[model samples]
Target: MRKIWTDGLALLGIALVLGGCATSKEDLLPHDHRTMLDIWNVETSGSAGGGPAARQLLDARQALRRPLTEADVQAAPSVQARYTRTAANEIHRQFHRLPNPDLLMYVFPHLAGSDPVPVPGYTTLFPLYQRVQYALPGERLEDY
Candidate 1:
């Protein structure tokens, strides 16, 4: 009984620690440049020199948010060019993005259940469990 009590306390502490790390919906919501850049490493590659232009746009975005009044909108001309190229590239990319054949089965884990959600329908969703949290019963926080 004493051993079980000790184990329970340990598991409770761990769950609290891990749950604190859960990603909130707020984190995934789009924000300004600083936040967007945190996840996406945007590059303007192959469009009037994408690398430098993209960086300049990033810098310009920072500058725009500051008190500085002298920032010319065209200060990052290369970035504009890159943006145009990127826009075109994006349209092209849409053609390349196709639905996977395996997705049909993946979506409908159980064929008998009231018709499963479409595969692509849930593509944008995230994983429910992390590898670190894959513990059984008393060994995990959920158990506690």
Candidate 2:
């Protein structure tokens, strides 16, 4: 009985500290893009071609899909999600929509929830938000 009490208390303490690190993922998410980029760096060339380099990029993309960041953490609330699918599948489905071209760079973090999602069949990306063009100096949409 005593051991159970102590263990429970210990678990509670750990949960509080770690949980306090974060709670709400939605707000944490835009910034979570930082974590997403870290994933991209290790996985892909952030390039156009789907040669050996692009797959490597996709690999890097899959690694850091979870939202864990200490840089700006606070006592925010967390989101809990569930799915009928297998655990891994929950994650796969989230980013499954991204085109293969942007898989590693743009898609991973968008998925990687607590729920299981499906991995897309093709290694290539869809047509939406397919290409990312950076803003030129003093350039806005009207400038073009």
TM-score of each prediction = 0.18, 0.17
Output the worst ten-in-a-row residue range by lDDT, candidate 1: 96-105
Q: What is the C-alpha lDDT profile of model 1 across 25-61, one tens digit per residue? A: 6787745555444334446333344577678877888
lDDT (10s digit) by residue, model 2, range 11-100: 999999999787787666555445666656544555333467768656777886757676325433321233235576555543222222
Error of 1 at 105 (Å): 91
User: When superposed on Cα atoms, how far off is each prediction in RMSD?
Assistant: 23.4, 30.1
lDDT of candidate model 2 versus the reference: 0.54
> What is candidate 2's TM-score against the reference?
0.17
